[model samples]
Structures are given as structure tokens and as C-alpha cells.
Target: MFHTAICDLLGIRYPIIQGAMQDAGGPRLVAAVSEAGGLGVLPTFGGTEAALRADIEKTSKLTRRPFAVNITPIGRAFTESRAAICIEMGVKIVTTGRGDPGLSIVEKMKAAGIVVIPVVPSVAHAIRVEQEGADAIVASGSEAGGHVGRVSTMPLVPQVVDAVKVPVVAAGGIGDGRGFLAALALGACGIQLGTRFIAAQESEASDWVKQRIIAARETDTIVSSLMTGKPVRALSSRILSAYEAERARCSDEQERAAARGRFLSELRDAARDDRTYAAGEISGMIRGIAPVRDLIEAIINDAAALAEKLHALAGRS
Candidate 1:
């Protein structure tokens, strides 16, 4: 079996981590990943303290294996509270993104014997978190779904690996065994996959959402700030298309303001008419939905076989 720092640190058999997606990383998905020998992270965004605790309890009841919980620390008011709750619940890992959770939160998690993995968008941020005692860094690139950084995974992984002492987990545009092997070649110890897991049968996403992902092309995802106040990558749905069309036609401030109102209205109820299947460019590579265990095993086994073949070819040369 393959092993890395992430596997050792997180106490998992595989170094694969299911990237924490808001609303998608619920108890069902989280428990399945952990049971399948990978780390599953429960996302704590857009939920209350009581709700978050209940989700944690549910995941804990489902699996005894180690799992993580993610918190967005940039603008969220209850970041510290969430961290405290994770620690209190004996979560094995805590992943922070968007921005650093400051030294206090990092130190607290570290002191509580929890590994801290921070998702970063740049080499600078990776180094900063490593210095702040982050056990590992997730080098999330622009190709990822939802909020992403400017760098692509191809360049960002190696850059972050070279700059930081901690283990780096590559994120973005990774779907199958080829992508897993590529990340290892780029000097990453592990991988955090968001889009790939969205199509998994265990995911909380609706069938319509999963079908939309399965039907999407490489160019179907667009990054826009219209959905949320901040820029996020989402499927190019009818709602997003309508919003863009209206904005282009608006010539004056009065028309622009009217378009903005209509845009927000459509975005709020997008699921009814135009579902926003927030996903990454890797959606193009996904073919079918399978159980989390089967998917993870397939990726690991395929990558292993490819590595063996490469080694044999290199020896002959």
C-alpha cells in the first residue's frame, strides 16, 4: 500500500482526502470516506453551533475511524467556536481555508493533539501556515470548484512543495488515477479532491446535480461573484447565463441596478429552474457514480499499476 506524511498524520490508510464542500460534506459522505480508509472532512460553513455539533455527532456514530472538520476563517464570525467544538468532540484533524485562523486557533488545535491542515492558494500562504504550525498544507488551485486561488495545480503543487517543510496536498483538476500519479510526481504527499467526490453515490447532492456534473464539459464551469459576494466556480447553468446576458444588455446604471436585483432573485431559487451545480473543471472526466469505497480503491489500484509499469520501463532504459 502507498503511504505518506498525510496518511501517518491523519492516521488513515490512504493519503486521499475528500475536499470539504459546503452542504455536500454531510454525515453520510464524511463517514463513508473515513470508513473507506481516507479522511472525510465535515464543512461547518452556513450552519449554527447546535447544527454543527449534531452533524459531528452523527458522523462519529457512523464511523470510529479518524475524520476531519473544516472551517472557513476569513469572514465567519464563529470560527473559534467551531474549532473549540471540533476539539471538544475529539476530531482528529481541523482544516482551515480562505484565510489563516490566526495563531490562537492553530495553537489550540495543535495543543489538543489535532493535526492542522490549512488550504492555501499560493506558495506564500503555504509557507506562512507552515510557520504557524500547520501540520500540512492543501495547495488548492484555480481549477478547483467553489472559491479558488489564482494558480493552477500543475504549477502550484511543486512551488508549494519547494517552499514549505510541511506535507503538501494538491487540489484542483484531479479526478482519477492519472491525476493522483501526477500529484505525486509534482512532489505532493497527498491529494484533496472536491469535484471527483461530488459524483460519488454517498454524496448528499441531488440526482439532478449529479447528472448535471456528469453532463458537463471542461468549459462548462465559470468563476463569478454573482452567486456569492466572493468569486466561486460553478456550473454554467441557465440562471448564470441569464444573469450574464442581462448584464451585457444593460447600458446605464438604472438598467444595471435592475439586472442585479433580477440576478439575485434567480440565484436564490436557482434549484427550481436553473440548478447551479457548483463543480470543478474535472467534472468532464467523471463517467459514473459509485460507492465511495469502490471509487477510492479503484483510484489507488490503478495508480499502483501505472507506477509499477513506469518503474519497469525505467529499469529497461
Candidate 2:
């Protein structure tokens, strides 16, 4: 009953897709999400070709459901190898982030009967991907984790939907069924959740990371370039505070350069004590960790109920 274009394309029961998080979306989490009827995307960041291949094989053993492999387009040296492995493994979808997946890469994936979904931050990029033969587009907003854009989900989803012919998936600031209903109302075919899934029991995130996200308030997150080289929304931590202090005190380019180096060094050494937790603004809504199956079922059930309530309201009006 809740089927959408994304569900049909990805072959999932619900339109919820787990966002690919570096070092967290391992085989267990990937398989669990797919098993629970949501699309799971495996992260290939900082992984070798053999490691990625083994992980894919492991996930395949865990669940017969379809899943996707995420490739960051930074290092072209290994991207092709990873793509080749994905094709060989019969992966149905490939999700690219950080940059455009060039025509060559897109053609390679399409020639293998794979769908290409690129994470786009703007309408221009969304249109470009559609023109480049992309099967779908994830319009990630500034409220998302890792890297973020300048727009919010409320506006970005509708704009991208209007600009592109392929299905649009909404990312950022989505936590519950109400958010799901809102995304559908905004013309998104599905919702991509990162922060909520990070707190799931199947997630590979450290216990401390999950605890931090559970304890976080809506205002606890800040979008800053201090975390990675890009603008990301993450929890306020000592690392972020120190970076902001240094950036504030720097008067010239040399001072800024020194501050950047120092901050990055500290970031590298940050352990559980000073580690920054990347999460969406919806962190406040997540109360505890549950298994992927329970989590997805509850979200879909809640969304269904909410949709019925809205329909009743409209009938009375």
C-alpha cells in the first residue's frame, strides 16, 4: 500500500533507504536493513577491492533482498575496480557521493543493468545526473550527516522533484513516520535515514557514539567545516569547539592555515573522549536502539496510521 517508484526500483517493501555511513554501515547493518524491507547501502570508504567484494558476498549470504554499494568519487584509482566488483557481484544499485559519477562510470553501471543513484546537493546537479542517465537521485540537504548542502529538506525535496524526471529520495532531518509523510507530501518517493539508523542495534557504530546520539538535543548539532574537509552537521564536541576558537582567532591566511593543521591533527587523535558524532537534526526524536526489523516495521506502521488520520481530516474539511 505504501509503494512508491523508489520501492519498485529498489525492490523494497517500504520506501525507507538506509543512508551509507563510513565505518558504520557494515555487512550486518546492510543485511539487516535489506532484510527488514528497506534498501541497505554498503559503504566502501577506506576499503580495498577485496574487502568490498568479501563484504558484498557476506551480505548476500545474510539476505536475499537487493542492496546497494556506495562509492565516494574522490579517488578514481579504485572506483573502477569497486564498480567492476559490484557488477560482477550482481549488485542492483550503485550510489555515488561527494562528486558526479562521470558518463563513463554511469554507462558502465547501466550497461550491466544496474541503477545509478547519485547524492546531489542542488537542482543543477540533479538535472545533470538525470541527463547523464542516472536512474534516481538522492537530494541530500544541509541537515544530513557527513557532508551537507546549504538548503533544508523541506525546500530541497520539492525543488529537486520539479527539476528531475527520476525518483527523488529525501535525506536529512527525517526520523519518524511524520517525517516520512512530510517527505511524500513534498513529492519525494522515499526517505533516506542516517542518524536514526546509526543508533540501531545492527549498526557498527561504537556504543559511545550511539549513547551520544541518544543524549543529543535538537540544538546540539552544528553544521561546520571543522569535522571533515566539507560542511557537515555533527554534535557539538571539544574538537568542534577548539576548531571554532582557532578559526575565530585567526586574522590572516597563514594563521588560518596553522589553525587548520592543528585542528586536523587533534581530530585525528580524537578518541571516544573528544570524538565528534555526526548525526541529523532529528537526533532528539530517537530514544533508544532497536533491531532493524523492529525499527522499520514501527516506522511503516506509524506512517500508515498517520496517513489515515490525515485522510480523515481532509474528509471532514
Backbone collision count in every prediction? 0, 0
Tell me, by TM-score, which candidate is best: 2
- C-alpha positional error of residue 211 in candidate 2 after TM-score superposition, expressed in Å: 0.7
Q: What is the lDDT of residue 112 in candidate 2?
A: 98
lDDT score for residue 68 of model 2: 94
Steric clash count of candidate 1? 0
In model 1, the runs with Cα more than 4 Å from the true position are 74-76, 242-262, 271-273
lDDT of 1: 0.88
Q: Can you write out model 1's per-residue Cα lDDT over 188-301, one digit (the tens) per residue? A: 998999988998999998887888889889999987656665667888877777777777788987887777787888678666547565699999888888999998999899
- Residue-wise C-alpha lDDT for candidate 2, range 123-176, written one tens digit per residue: 998999899999999999888887888888999999999998899999999988
